[model samples]
Target: MTIPQAQREAAELLARLSGAAPVETHISAVYVGRDTAWKMKKAVALGFLDFTSLAERERFCRRELELNQPHAPGLYRDVVPLTRGPDGRLREGGDGPAVEWVLRMAPVPAGDFLDEIAAREGLPPRLLDAVADAVAAMHAAAPRAETDPPAAMAAILDGNVPSALRAGLDPGRVRAWAAAARAELARVAPALAARGAAGFVRRCHGDLHLGNFCLWEGRPTPFDALEFDEALARIDVGYDLAFLLMDLDLRLGRAAANRVLNRYVARGGDAGLLVGLPLWLSLRAMIRAHVEGTRGRDWSVLLTAAEAHLAPAATRLVAVGGLQGTGKSTLARALAPALGRCPGALVLRSDEIRKRRFGVAPEARLPAAAYAEGVSAAVHAEMFAMAATALAAGQAVVLDAVFLDPGHRAQAEAVARAAGVRFDGIWLEAPLEILRARLAARHGDASDANEAVLLRAAAVDPGAMAWHRVAADDGAAAAARSAIGMKGHSMC
Candidate 1:
C-alpha cells in the first residue's frame, strides 16, 4: 500500500532473477529474466485503482489476461502466483496464500515496438492503416458493457480536471473548458446512451498508446491493456480509440492522426460515436498534460495539441481519378490527410466499395462480369452517395476511382455540387507499360484490377481532359504536394 513496501518487495523479488533486472514504471515492474518476462503490479493505491492486497493484485492479474487476449494473444499468458510454503520459501503458484501476483508473458521484440519504430521510420501509410484496421477489428469483436453515460463522463471530468489544473494551466481556463466539455457531453448524452445500448462499450485496452503496441510478425499487436479499473476501460469504442488518436496526433501530426481515424471509420467504426469525439480527445489530452506535469515536464505543448485537435476543420470533396496503374489511391491517401478535419478526410475508394459489394476480400479475383457496365455504374453511384453524405455532414471526402469515362467524372462533380461543397479533381496519367508493371507487382491490395483492366481503361475514350492533369510517370509527389499544400505529414 506504501511506496517503501513496494520498493523493498520488488527489490527482493527482482534479486532472484538470473539475468537483467526488471524495468520500473509508475504501476508495475517487469523482469526480463529469460525468454519469458514477468510483470508484477506494485502494492499501491491510487485514486483510480487499488492493488494494495495480494487478492486485489491477483484479480487484476486475471483481468489483464482476460481483457488483453483478443488483440494481444500469445503475449499475456498465465498469472504466476508468488506464494510462501510451510517452510517459508517463496516460489511460483502453490497451495499457500499468494504473497504476490505476477503475470508471466511471452517477450515481444523490444526493438520493434510501434513507438520505437515510429520514432525511427515514422509509421508509413500502410502501417498506420494496418493499426486502424486492427483497432477496428478489436472494437468490432469487443462485447459491450452497460454504463451510465452522463455519470461516467462526469466522474472523468471531476477526477482529472484538478490534475490538469495543477499542470500549470490557469484555473479559470481549466474550469471554463471543463464546463464546456460537460455541457457538450450532456447535449449528446442520448447518442452516447444509445451507443452503449447498442453494445459499443466493452472491456477495451485502457492504456492504448504507441508504447503498448508492438510490431510482432509484421503486424501491430497491442499489449498491456488496462486491468485495474473496469469503469475506466469499459467505455464507448470511440472513447477507447480517442486515446490513440490523440496520442498519434501528439507524437506525429494531425494528418497522421486523421489517417488513422478515417481508416478506422472505413472499417466499421460507428459513425454515431463521432459526435463525442472532441470531448474524448480533450479528456485524453488533459490526462497526458497532468501526467507530464507530475513528472515535472513542460505539459503546455499538450495543451496546444489538445486545443488544435478539438477545433473542427472545414469540409470539402476531393476526387482522384485515373487508370488502374496511375497511382490514384496513393495520391488520394496523401491528399486525404491534407484536406478537411483531423486525421484528414474520409477515403471512399471504389475498389474497396466494389469488393464490399461483391462480398469478397480485397484480394479476391472477381470475374469479368463483376466489372461489367452495370457493376461499374453501381460502384460509382454508391461511392458518390457515401461521399455526398459525408460532405453534407461537414466531413471531408476523397473519392478514389478510375473516372476514365466523362459521364462518371461529371457525376462525381455533380455529387459535390449537390452537397454544396467545393470540389477539386486530379487526373493522373502514366504510360501503359508503367501501369502494367505496377498492377503486376500489386498483391494483397484493395484493388483487384489487373493488366487487362489497365489496358481496357487505357483504351477508353475519356472525352475532354478538363480536370487538373498531372504526369504520374515519375510519381505524383510534386503534384500531390502542390494540390493539397500539405507539409507532408509532420511527426513529433
Candidate 2:
C-alpha cells in the first residue's frame, strides 16, 4: 500500500524529532525514537473504523490516552497535535491549527514483548500466571456497558464474515464457518443477552494478545488496545479474553492457553463463563481469521482449529506433586492443554486455593499457622473438592500440590476413580540443595514457600509412593517432558 500524502508529511515532520524511521500498521503509523514512540492514526476509513477527519482522529487519540492509562499506567503519554507554526513548515506540538494528531508514548523494551520472549524461550513461562492476574484485575476494574451485548456481538460477527470474504479467503470455507458460528451464537443468544444484563459486558481491551504486551521493569503491561470502535470494543468480557486464549492455544499450545483461562477463573473471574467459552472462542477465532485473511494471508487454518476447540473432549485427571521449587506447578501448567479438551485442563494449585480460602490476594504472604498440619489438610481438601467438581462436570483436572501425605495422594486418586476418569500421578524431585536455591529465587509469586519451608519439606518422608518419579533438576522444558513425555500437542 502506498503512503498517503498526509501521512508522508506527518512522517517527514516526525523524523524531525529524531532521524529514526516510522513503522506503519493498517490503522496507524508508529515512529519509535530513542526514549519515546509516536503513533499517528491513518486518516483513512476502514469499514468498521473511521478516521476520515482531523477532529475525529484527535478525539480518538485523547480517548486512547484516557482509556489505556488505568490498565497500562505510565505507558501512554499525552496526545500531541501535529500542527504548523507561523512558518509554512509542519511541526509537532506547534502553536497553530492542528493538521493531525499522534499519541505519544514511552518506548517499551522491544525484546520484552511476550511474543518475542516466547519465540526465544521455546516454552510458555510461569510468568503467564502474572499476565492472567493482570488481565483479571483490569477486567474487574473496567466499566460495564449499557447496550445489549447480543446485538453488539451479532453485528460484529456479521461484519467479520464479509471482511474475510473480501480479503480473498476461500469463500466456501468462510461461509461454512460463519454459518456454524452464527448458529451457535443463535443457540446461546439468550445466555449472551443475560450475561450482558448481569454486567458481563464491559469496555475491554478488544485486541489482547502476547504480541500487544511488553514488560516494564519486570511487570507485564498490556498496551495497544482497540480504540477505533466503541461497539466493537465494548462487549462481553469473555469475548475480550477469548482473543488472548485463542492466540495462546494457536501459537504456544493448549496447555499454555488453558493456564491463562483456568488462572483467570481461579483468580475470581466467574467460573460460569466457561459455559459460554465455545461461542466466545468461535467469535474471537473468526475475527482473527478475518483480519489475517483480509490482509491476503491464509486464515482458514485458524478457523478450522478454533472450530474444533468448540467440540468437547474426553476428560482426564492428572495430579502433579512435589515440594516447592520441584517445578510441580510449572510442569502441571505446561502439561494441562494437551490433556483433555480445547483450552486444556483446569489446574487447581494449592497455594492459590489457600490464598482464596483466606480471602487474600495471591501474592499476599500468609502467617505460619496457615501452613500448620490441620490448615494444610483443609487447603488440600478444598483444592481436591474444586478439582473433583470440575472433573465431574467433564472438565479435565490437574491437582498441583506437594501431596506429602499418603492419604492426600490417595484422595486425589479416589476423586478421579469416583468420577470414572483415567488418572496419572506425577512425582517431581531434585536434590535438597537445588530445591533450596530455587525456592530462594522466588519473587512476587502466589507460593509463599521460602528456604525454611523447603528444608522442612525435605525432611519429610513420603512413603510407599506409587506415582511416576521424575527428576526435575533441569529447567522447565525438561521437567515438563519428564512428567508428560510426548503427550502434549498444540491444537492445530
Best by TM-score: 1
TM for every model, in the order presented, reads 0.88, 0.81
Best by lDDT: 2
Worst 10 residues of 2 by lDDT: 483-492
lDDT of each: 0.77, 0.79
lDDT (tens digit, per residue) of candidate 1 on 1-492? 223474465457654762666677877878776677888888777767787877888898888888787677777778877777677867767887767788888777678898988888799878998898888888778877888866798888788778887667757767777777777678768877877787888877778889988876679988888877788888888898999998898788776787788777666624555667777888888888888888889888776665655565677777889889788877887777667656567788888778768866455678878888899888888888788767654568888888888888898889889988777788998888888999898887888787876777788799997788888865586676566444555311
CA displacement after TM-score superposition, residue 231 of candidate 2 (Å): 2.0
Instruction: Give the lDDT of residue 140 in candidate 1.
Output: 75
| Candidate 1 lDDT score at position 111 | 80
Those runs of model 2 whose alpha carbons end farther than 4 Å from true positions after fitting are 6-8, 120-126, 186-198, 320-331, 357-364, 371-394, 402-492
* Candidate 1 backbone collisions, by pair: 258-343
lDDT of 2 at 451: 89
Instruction: Give the per-residue lDDT of model 2 (tens digit) for 1-492.
Output: 544676788878887675676677878877788888888888788777888888999999999988888878778979988788777878878778888888999887668888888788833455887788888888999998898866776787788777777777778877877777777778768877888889988999988988988887678778888887788788778888888988887888776788788878778636546546777777788778777876767887777875775666777788889888998877877777666766877888889888877878778899988888888888888787787667754577888899888898999999999999888888887888888888888787789988887888778999998988888855654545445543435421
lDDT (C-alpha) at residue 467 in model 2: 88
